[model samples]
Target chain A: MRTHHVTCDDDVKLLAALASNRDAGFEPLVGAYQRRVYGLALRLSASPQDAEEIAQDTFVRAYRALAGYGNDQIRALALRAWLYRIALNVFHNRVRVRRVPTSPLELDDGDGPAFRIEDGDPRTRPEQTLIASETERELAALIAALPPHLRVALVLRHVEGLGYAEIATLLDAPVGTVKAHVHRGAKLLRASLEAHNREEAKVEALL
Target chain B: MTTTNRTPRTPRTPRAPATPPDASLAEVRALLGRLRALADVDAPAALLSAVLGELGLDAADRYFSLRTPVGQIFVAFNDRGLSAVMRGESAADFERAAHALLGRAVHPATEPPARLVAALERSLRGEGKPVLRFDLRGLSEFEQAVLLKALEIPRGEVRPYAWIAREIGRPRAVRAVGTALAHNPIPIFIPCHRVVLSDGTLGRYSMGGDQIKRAILAAEGAAPDVLEELARAGIRYYGSDTTHIFCFPTCGHAHRISAAHIQHFASEAEARAAGYRPCNVCRPALGA
Candidate 1:
């Protein structure tokens, strides 16, 4: 059951625009996917600053690549998968060079909410809002702490709502391998959550 | 049978099957929903211009004459952000000047974006954090750093070019910082006017002149007259004798220091040696 997707409905229109002129079309293309690309980069690398650089470089590479492509080739591109592939590659190369990845997940103080915040309902209690935000932040930190391969696979599968075959294409891996990674990722995440809940249970008992 | 095509082939030899977490479709959906929410994030506003800045796309695509406290100035922008702010003789003159500066054609826009108009208006009032992004195409890294640091100067207070240099981690580039500020295309919004000379005097402004700079500063609530008097007296900082704190003469607290307890320092070391500490509000040491 695919649960999500990072898709653009105007990929065809955007491609037609780019096919005519890269300059005029690139801004709209960027506008459509900038947040999605930044989200993918942030997931792969747990730092927002790194995510921004990676997203910027990804578009630069994407722009140059599109410039060299034929108009037909440009129109045929699977926009979401193609852009995420570039962003993922950029994130990897950066990690290879920089080596040590320091993310806010390592320090609770440095990270604020990475999730979107809706204006709170007046009926909701302040403490409930606080608890929900805290939970979301903790859940995000747990996702960030996953191993790179599992993290990438799980994010693509669930966050992007992508099929295993589409993810396999993006990862350049076998469909079985991609599915295995997703399965392992989910199992590990569930176990970690259970462990965390038990620890909280002990703290609550003490209190 | 219908679901068989969607499932992947078994890649390895089957071992004892372990209980899979969230095997139920509904539970899996719930788990994935949490992942999606947690993974979603927003891009920063500066990212659009940052891309253009990286691509070196001098995007001075359109212009509109903005009515500002400093008078009418042509503001050029693209989808990224405000690219340039310049004063010229006329519409044709503005087009020619902006074109020469950007090395690109500048078209006249009928109305700037409402958000941009609002940002410009708020900037004139010397408000808090800036709301608009500057495209900053064709500027060197050193120059961009100088301009951005200048933006941090509170509207009414003044810092010397040396303060900008040190703030950007280029302590010896005071003269170069001056050059950068002078070349700043987005002047008033970036607030290059708030930076004065180390001797407490207003300096040359590339957009207009020193007179305009003083006028803008005075409008923002800085006592340009008092700053000039301090420069004439060779007093760069003022100290409260009772409070034992020293601050730049332009500091808001400096204006409140009663005359009887007022002491002055020509240099930071002089104040430090006189048993006075740098004011937390002005941060004399940081600026000096």
Candidate 2:
């Protein structure tokens, strides 16, 4: 495996090139941040295609705004926040155009297929794949059922592993409110997953 | 970094004859980790190229707003649109302003343009007459007052579903007010889209869903950004799998009620018979 290390100086160089209108500068920046930004968009949008579009838009918008950027400004603002903000705007626009009910499970564009975990892939050593698969499904469902705010908050907090203050800054809410959102959101996830497990067991018994 | 190198994976030992691979819990987590690795799948190359094609290098100062679903851009006017609609700006503040105007998630910078400002002014001045007025033509003594009251809602702003219920003196007739707004034929002139979910989401709009309503607002500079206008402002509680209720009342307090909380009365007389007074706050029937 190849190891890649990103120093702050590398970002500074990229920022300078991007500001100076050098197309090559975007390559390194895109490589370093695309996955993180795309992942954020997908979680927010709950659809891979929408996530991709939002991520692309985020970069385009970021590039356009790069000229006015300074090193101090870049250090102060997490690129993630700016990118996520752009992606969320794009997602909100989708929400409006499609008028998809605000529920996460209801994919507004029905053609965008649902993402499913592999159930029977043979590459894995078989020891406890079934148990893991079940758990994965449960986690996905729990995420889908959460209210939009709670789900986004939890994904940014735990899954992305951002600190509470960082999340509060990203969300533009008070730190206390951000903490509450994460705490309640996690509790709700645990309860929902537990309930789903119980219900699945009952259905299996019936079958 | 070598492009051909795959991410390192923990090597799995050959399975023991007696112990099947299915029995290994550690491997299950590893499988999940691999699936998670796929989470960063990039957008298709064609899509990326297309987006880049649209992005010109020197338009950094311009402001553009794209609609949801990712293909169409509604407004891409240069910085003039932003300045025409907002207060002041710093250099880097341009993107931030554009972002806010588009209503994505960022820190609250400025409240977008007030929804009702120009529309209310136009209505008060009686300019831009409705191309087609519905039953509101030759308004009755009582009806004229109600219609004028409904016009008070500015664009990108909202009043409660029940507020209109009380405004027309049909204090018990929230449903009747909805009917009146539903049939509001003059959208831009009457500005019926301003009425929203009591909790501030784009509720059921007579124009369409919240998006079209937002598009109209965006056109009017009523909201700075689409997300700011569309973001749900209040709490929603789901009573069951299929039933959800918005907890904020039209009157501003957070009140939880079920779908069945409001009885469906077939006619205005039937609603009156049920003794539910028109909510004094919203004046449901009054468009003003």
Candidate 3:
């Protein structure tokens, strides 16, 4: 999904009030963005519990650093990007805690509860349905198996739909490298799919 | 060489090195597609509430100067090994506050912490006011417009940033929208904390960063941890008597669902009249 700018004169005013200290200003900001942030948090963390913590942390961080946020440049950074960075950090730190290792299973399926195949907008056409169900499952498995950097790059580019430039800023990588990663990632996925299909056919023949 | 007409032939160029394996492309595509599918995933009420409460307390203490003092603090570490700190009040006070809040304390590195203290001092003095409000202040006209639309997102709700960007007539500015939010000013009220990375990651927050972000959502009445907390309290989505529904008013692209789509509706007519069924994904009616 694409992001649009929404700062208004009132936001500016509230921001001004916030510069010193203004709890009153916090509500409007909350009223404005609570859903967007929380929603994004849910998606990134893949766990309501984790997302909730990340969302609150994002705000507290923004509040504390309101002094150094540097006037709207953060605007150049999407709430998504900023929050993702925070979430990633949180996820990484959590990993350091020696929790039971998360399996390679994808959250939508293997890892967490598997989604009911019939779930989704049933009104969708058969063709779209087939593509969505089969291709999507196969693709997710392929992605889960990729290297972390490549996987993240693909997620940001295709899933997040971020621009190369924006991604460069977020990932701290050159645009050329980002492009290469995306292209290579796509190629690898295509190859894996072909290979998987072949294996499935071989197993079926034996059966 | 071309002028020699067929007399001089140039040697063929050697093929370039084989491209490296991306090994994850299909997975990435699937993951991306899954994000679109899960767009309707609702933010839990209990979780959001906790996060908002934490943020409310922090914001109240910081910008609002509410009854509380030193609401929150954010720390960052750069590649240069330089560390920065942004606290609500005095740098020293904020440091103490952090120690108190986190229940653990580490001595600040003399040089970096000192530099951070200096920056906070200048910020408190009002010299970097623009810098302080950069999240909203630095936005371009278009970005500002997009963010304004994003701000409309209600508590415990989410909409695609791309859709919002499209609503602003800048369909291609999806990334820009995320950027705008990253620099959001008056974060709690603007609720930039509510925004997420499109991949569904909670994304990053500059102030108090991630943990603080989580805390704020918890306070807002959203149930990010409803399941866990409920489990601890001996709760479950399937309760005794009444059937519950969790409706999400956001997601304009979503269809209007009625009772029939639900597994166990009150009655058949109630389900059909709505003309559409509730999604099984989030169970708008079930509150799952």
Backbone clash numbers for all candidates listed = 1, 42, 125
True contacts kept of 3: 0.20
lDDT of each: 0.77, 0.49, 0.48
Using lDDT as the yardstick, the better of models 1 and 3 is: 1
Tell me, by TM-score, which candidate is best.
Answer: 1
Per-model TM against the reference: 0.49, 0.38, 0.36
lDDT accuracy of residue B203 in candidate 1: 85
List ranges where model 1 is wrong by over 4 Å: A1-9, A103-131, B1-17, B20-29, B58-288
lDDT of candidate 3 at residue A113, scale 0 to 100:
36
Query: lDDT tens string, model 1, B33-120?
Result: 7877855556777677678667765364888887777688888888778888887648899888888888877898877778878888
Off-target runs (Cα >4 Å) in candidate 3 are A1-22, A27-49, A67-81, A95-101, A104-145, A188-207, B1-41, B56-288
Model 3 chain A lDDT-worst window of ten: A112-121
Give the alpha carbon lDDT tens digit for every residue of A25-123 in model 1. Answer: 888788888888987887676566677889999999998888689988988888988999998898778767877655444322223433332222334
Q: How far does residue B112 in candidate 2 sit from its true spot (Å)?
A: 48
